[model samples]
Target: MKLENKKVVVTGSEGFIGSHLVEALIVQGAEVTALVQYNSFNSWGWIDSLEPTVKNSIRVVSGDIREYDNIKKIIKGNDVVFHLAALIAIPYSYQSPMSYIRTNVEGTANVLEASRELNVEKVIHTSTSETYGSALYVPIDEKHPLQGQSPYSASKIGADMLAQSYHLSYELPVATLRPFNTYGPRQSSRAVIPTIISQISSGKKIIDLGDVTPTRDFSYVKDTVNAFLKVAESDLSIGKIMNAGSGKEISIGQLFYTICKLMGANVELNIEQQRIRPANSEVNRLLADNRYLKEVTGWESRYSLEDGLIETIRWIDKNINHYKPNIYNV
Candidate 1:
């Protein structure tokens, strides 16, 4: 299961975690093929942010994950496929659930089926904490009942099931990485960390946000990416689903104040109606029991919340122009 000199295909290689994963793979001396969403301009998405040497080392292909034939073609000769391409905005899912179904559920099926046929050595499927909606108990584990509170979560649940079924029914060499609120540089503004940092750095005194009572266990992107490599290298991870997080939870209000303290900005909270999820659909708390990730891959959270937040703020400060502070990113 050594990654050195192995051929790896990373779907959604243009995204926050995906781009970081691609870079990490290059560091492991893997021959990388990065699959970004197709565009006329031939944009590489966040892969464009990679160091020239790392970017040049990877073979970039622009293709939609929803296309089965396209996925099969790109994945045929790949030894490993890290499937991450998806429509992730929760609010946007409310507006367009079908798109989520197509990209998340069907796209995952494409990855699993194609990987099975090609006999790829590994398939790293991405899952989310949202599938466990509002934590039934503190420090949620892999055994928790999945509750699809939103279309986004529902779509992910379907995708996760497909990945697991592939392993059980067909013995596909697949592992699922379930992350709790991964935040860092290059994360989209639709995410909470970036939203807070962008708004504060933009000098907005009144911060418009959704429900602040919900707590999240945040994992730094670097730590999460490292875990992906660990999972890929371990035979113990095959046919298993694991969690990644700091094992600590923070309320959104607390997170906001922490960011403000670091940025030295005094801000008032203005809860916006449009930004809030339906009351019934909102996940009030999320805390990860990340023991399984440790058991399988010897992974643990490497960055403290404040340390990660500070780094994120520094990144957002430099990339402030990319965000529209007053608008709801969804």
Candidate 2:
């Protein structure tokens, strides 16, 4: 299923990855409809910052994913649905777990049911490495036992299950694309990459962070977006949960130091208590075994970690005013 001239609806299109995916789909000649969460401010998040031509190319709608009728309506005519909407912050999830359940679990059900009803050609359900929790072994694969160490991850696990069940029970043409830490220009400070870059770019010599010992397999946003397109286009991806990552891991401390080296900043790290996850809840390591996705879609990680970080740093530096270095984003 080539994306050219296909009608695509991207849920959470206002967000970091969603905005980038929307732009990519438009470039691929897909008719795009962007579904941003409703807000009175009429804000489109990162979509609002896109190039005028890119921003104007797609249709944008505001609605809640939790609303079945609304989602069904917006998704009715689209050939492909990329479901990326969810409450993603782990810390915030501790404070409000029910919200995560409603938005992530119930919301995903809405997408699956609506897609089944509409007979959409494909539904690319988004999953996170967080659902795998701390890796029990290096280079985790699709068969790894899911351990939800946090409420946010637990909610995602539920959502992933729904996507898988929908495929088995109803033969919904759905596939779950589980991506390891994705970072790029439009990422908010809630993520570590942006937090580090925003602080250093704001001239902070000492940066506050949490749990630097944990390692993550970070994928550049563009690579992840490519994975989404690949997964949607391949019939081989149907009913499968595939991983996409650089297949490399770096500790947070190492990541921070790398960023400091890249930006030429001598920075002191202060681990803050409030920012730390509960000891048992912390995901200590994550590295992806992306062979299945590569075999299925011929997708590969294009950007090296350093190259991706360099690009992220450049973007955050220019948009430093949009971030608040003093505030802990989560």
Candidate 3:
């Protein structure tokens, strides 16, 4: 379970959370390979933001997660594989659901198959709070009912099942690490935190948003990355679903005010119809019960919501130029 000198491959290593994870793995003394999606521009997404020493410590590979042969080649000798790559934009999924299915569902199958065929030590599958949909009960547990309210969440549910099925059917060493609304530096504007911050940072007096009544349990990016590592390092977590969250809930309206208070700005909230999901498709609330994660891996959120928001606000302030506030990011 120790990461020291362990060989690890992280798919989506160029993403917001994935990029941070690569840094953490390096700090933990793990030999790291970062798998970024191949692109002609040769952009490595958020990984490019990493400090030079940390960035240069790891190997970077460019390939599609949907390609089975390429994944097999990368995953063959690694001790663990963290599968985080997927099409995750919810609004875009409505327009292009097939893309989500292929990348989230089928791409996960490719990772599991590679692990099975090549004898990888472990596979860490990334999952979202969206898979649980609205909370029928407060403080949702791993045993809570899963409702896929959107095509994006549905695709993730399919991916989660595929991970579990691999463990049961093929005895693949895999665990699904489910995380709630995680936000921090390097997050895309497609996410609410960056969207709100970008609009505010861009001097927009009126913020366009969808439902503000729904609530969420937000995990800071670092906390989520810690969970990914702790879960993978624990034999008890194998074949199980573990959630990473702050065990707290805040409505979107409350969250907005919190962020604005931190920014010391007064802004008007404008609920745009186009930004709202179909009523039935919207998830109303989510709160995580993280007892099992702590029990198994001694994992708990280290950052308070206010502290994390302060850090995020600072990062976005310096990096706001990367976000386009005039258009809805979805």
Candidate 4:
């Protein structure tokens, strides 16, 4: 499936990864429709930060993804659909699980339903590594038993299942691309990488954090976006559940220290009770097994953690006002 001259609809095209994916799609010569969540302010989220030339090339649509009618309308006449919209904050999910269910689960259902009805040629559904919870074993694969330790993870798991069911029951050309901790520019401070960078860039000596023992497999946003495009273009990926990651792991404590070193900041850690997840709900580790993705889509991570962190820190430094290091973001 060549993306050149193809009409593609990218849901959540205003978000962190979604915005990057939209830019990438345009570069690949796709006629892109970016479906952003509607707001009274007409805010476009990260899409607003994109270069003017790229932003101007996209057709932006504003609507609620949970509405089947809105989704169906946007999905019609598109060659491919990339579903990346969702409520992703773990802390916020704890506060309102129902909101996560509505957006992440039901919203995904709307996209799948629309794709099925319109007979879209391809659909690439985004899944999070968080859905695997703490790895019962290292190098977690698609066969790993999913454990929804947090409401956010649970909601993603629900979305992934819905995508799979659509493929199995209706023979929809859908694939689930589960990506590990994707970080880079335009990432909100709610995520760990941005949280640390925002605080250090703010010249804070004391960085507030939750438990830092938990480890994660991180991937750069660009690499993750490339994997999505590759999966969408590869006929071999249809009906497959694949992983996209660096196949490496780093603990939160170590990652924080590394960031401090990179930024030349001498920051001390302050354990904040409020920042911690419910003890039982915290996922202690995540490591990705991306062998299948490499074999099927011929995709591999291009950015190392250190290199990606450097780029992210640079972006956060220039856009310091976008983040409030003093407040807990979510």
**Highest lDDT scorer:** 2
- Give per-residue CA lDDT, model 3, range 141-184, as digits (tens): 99998898999999999999999999999888888888999999
* Tens digit of per-residue lDDT, candidate 1, span 69-125: 988999988899888889999999999999999999999999899899989999999
- What is the lDDT, from 0 to 100, of the residue 252 in candidate 3? 94
Clashes of each: 0, 0, 0, 0
lDDT of each structure? 0.92, 0.95, 0.93, 0.94
In candidate 2, list every pair of residues with a backbone clash.
none
Range of the 10 consecutive residues with the lowest summed lDDT in candidate 3: 236-245
**Candidate 1 lDDT (Cα, whole model)?**
0.92
Listed in order, each prediction's TM-score against the native is 0.99, 0.99, 0.99, 0.99
Q: lDDT of candidate 2 vs native?
A: 0.95
In candidate 1, stretches whose alpha carbon ends up further than 4 angstroms from where it belongs are none
Sort all candidates by lDDT, best to worst. Answer: 2, 4, 3, 1
TM-score of 2: 0.99
**Model 2 residue 213 distance off true place after TM-score fit, in angstroms:** 0.4
